[model samples]
Target: MKTSTELALSLNPAKPRCTQPRRWLAAIAVLSVSWPVLVWADCVDTRKATAAEVEFHGRAMAALVAALPPVPVGGKLQNKDSVTTLGQQCRGVTGDFNLEATRFYELNFRKAIVSVAINVRQLRTDAAGLSESYGVASPNRSAALRVNNVVWTVSGSDSPLRQALVDAMDRTRLQGWVDKPLPSVAESEALASQAVPAAVAVPATGAPASNASTVQTAPQPAVAPEPLREAVDAVNKLRGLFGR
Candidate 1:
């Protein structure tokens, strides 16, 4: 038995052939308009951040990695040409940015984001101390804040689902308290000053939606794991930009 679609096509054979191209064109148009909206969807279930966002941050991370003069882990930097080497590395890493980006964000994206925050904190501390000790101008570069904004922007703004995903994936089970939102240096330090409070699950009982859990927290630890050695090196190089 011929289907209704097939029967209709037999009656107007050219109709299907002509409409095929039109249908494809319409789909392409719709996707172009809706693409950004989908990017704002939950990164956990949707995992649909805009490709531009991913590519941008991936390149930035890679470039930043390259800019620093390499100091051996806990060893002093021996080369003055570290920034030059890093610049070349940045180009190399960013050459096939899509693949580099996949490796960047697949497992270690959050850790990279956190590392930026930590470095920002450390830089602020260093700047403050330098200003005080040398009576120099404030060197607040605002790198941390910029990095936070970009991370959240590309990754997706915080929503309940996003936080829950953080909970589900975190090995530390810190998903409850962390909310996994990037913090300003003040927020970071304030969190570190107090003992952590417990995370509370909102009762889904007789509720319209199933989303549960409210995080309550006292403070974040003053320190994150030592900043990525490469990132820290990049931060220091910014000193030359400022003629420090």
Candidate 2:
């Protein structure tokens, strides 16, 4: 007697035998398309920030706070009037913005000059409330504050991120801040003139002492490094969850 497979094939020879391979190909195609999404999802995993990143954030936050108009003596920072005023001031500097549930503003500070996402949230509720608000207090708290978005690519003075960074650098008055505006042509020429040293007259071997022209070398000024890119797309992705 023939084996079951052989008997079935003999009975229905017209049936396609390539179905298994076709199914496998379809599965592989799907997996190829889905692989990137899976990788991006994994980007949400909590990761430690580098020292430079932490320091940069501290400075950036200070710059932002400094840019805000001072709160009136009795006014709270989170109050409606204060929020509105702060939002206006921030927008004047940074362009359109999203005020996040009266807590912090959601800003897309990603540009060629700076890259950051200001969506990290803090746990302000009790443990029981936190658990109810977000399941599993430990992981939820970390997840709420994780940075996961890819940095956006933007440039020019029209960019809110670039403008915000420039304003920040201006406020700090630090020399060689990466986000500082490039000097205008006239300004650069003036600086070049100032940098160049005066040439002195020198004596030649057989001639009187005052006759020869001497060359003077001028050193080039150090250029600031370009702003660095970092993970900054996470805020746009999780706006709903974080708006609270």
Candidate 3:
């Protein structure tokens, strides 16, 4: 005797359950066609950097810039003594910069040290010889200084958004900076104006300057130093030796 349920099934002949998977796949395919990629956030706006974010950029740049020091000096590339001196100098400078970076991370991410290092390196690398060694071969010292200055300015800003805006030039398009003028201090100020929140004051002069209620510009500590002048002159003489 056929039960009522069996009789209904026989009349209707229910569709196979396997078809559900196919239906799901079809829906997913439609969605994929409509939206091919997943997007977590839009780049529509900019804001201030958290303490952690500032530390991250500051430490990362410090590590990178530190690795660049002990710029290959003296022509005797084939001499063991010269190479040994270079190694020793590199080790010393790397350790010093790494210590500064660690302190910057532990502290409030103050950028003065990083900016000083970048500034001195900018001066050192102005000679084509030294610049070529770093693979940044730019003849224009002013241009290189401008690019370095902008990086130091924005990365240390209170706004992570402003940093991202300049990262396109400092990080991705660095090679393009060899012949072109990269972003300037004024340009970074413009970016900050747009990206910084209304509640937070933006620095008018740039980083190493207070972004507090009243902006104050401090003279760069790295400039006008007798040691820097001597170091730069010495490296320039080395370049003459190598005809760079």
What RMSD does each model have against the real structure? 32.7, 34.1, 31.5
Residues 1-244 of candidate 2: C-alpha lDDT, one tens digit per residue: 8999999989888855778889999999999999977855634433445443344334433332333323222223323322221211111122112211112112333222222222223322442211112122232211222221111111334433333333332222222322343333354344434432212222355954563456556898875454421223455557767883
* Winner by lDDT between candidate 2 and candidate 1: 2
lDDT of 3 by residue, 1-244 (tens): 9999999999999776798889999999987876723331232333454443334334434333332212111211111111000111121111111111111211123221122122123324342211222233223322222323222222334343323223322333333333344344354344434433112223566556466847778886667679889999999999999999
Q: Which residue segments of model 2 deviate by more than 4 Å?
A: 1-45, 73-178, 181-244
Candidate 1 residue-wise lDDT, 1-244, digit = tens: 9999999988987733578889999999999999966865433232333444444334444433332212212222222321111111121122211111111121212211111111121223242211111111222322222232111101223333223223322222121212233333344344335323223233365846444455557897675456676687888899879988
Off by over 4 Å in 3: 1-113, 116-170, 173-176, 194-244
Give lDDT for model 2: 0.34
Clashing pairs in 3: none
lDDT for each candidate structure: 0.32, 0.34, 0.34
Q: Of the candidates shown, which would achieve the greatest TM-score relative to the real structure? A: 2
Models 1 onward score TM values of 0.18, 0.20, 0.18
The TM-score, computed over Cα atoms with residue i paired to residue i, of candidate 2 is 0.20
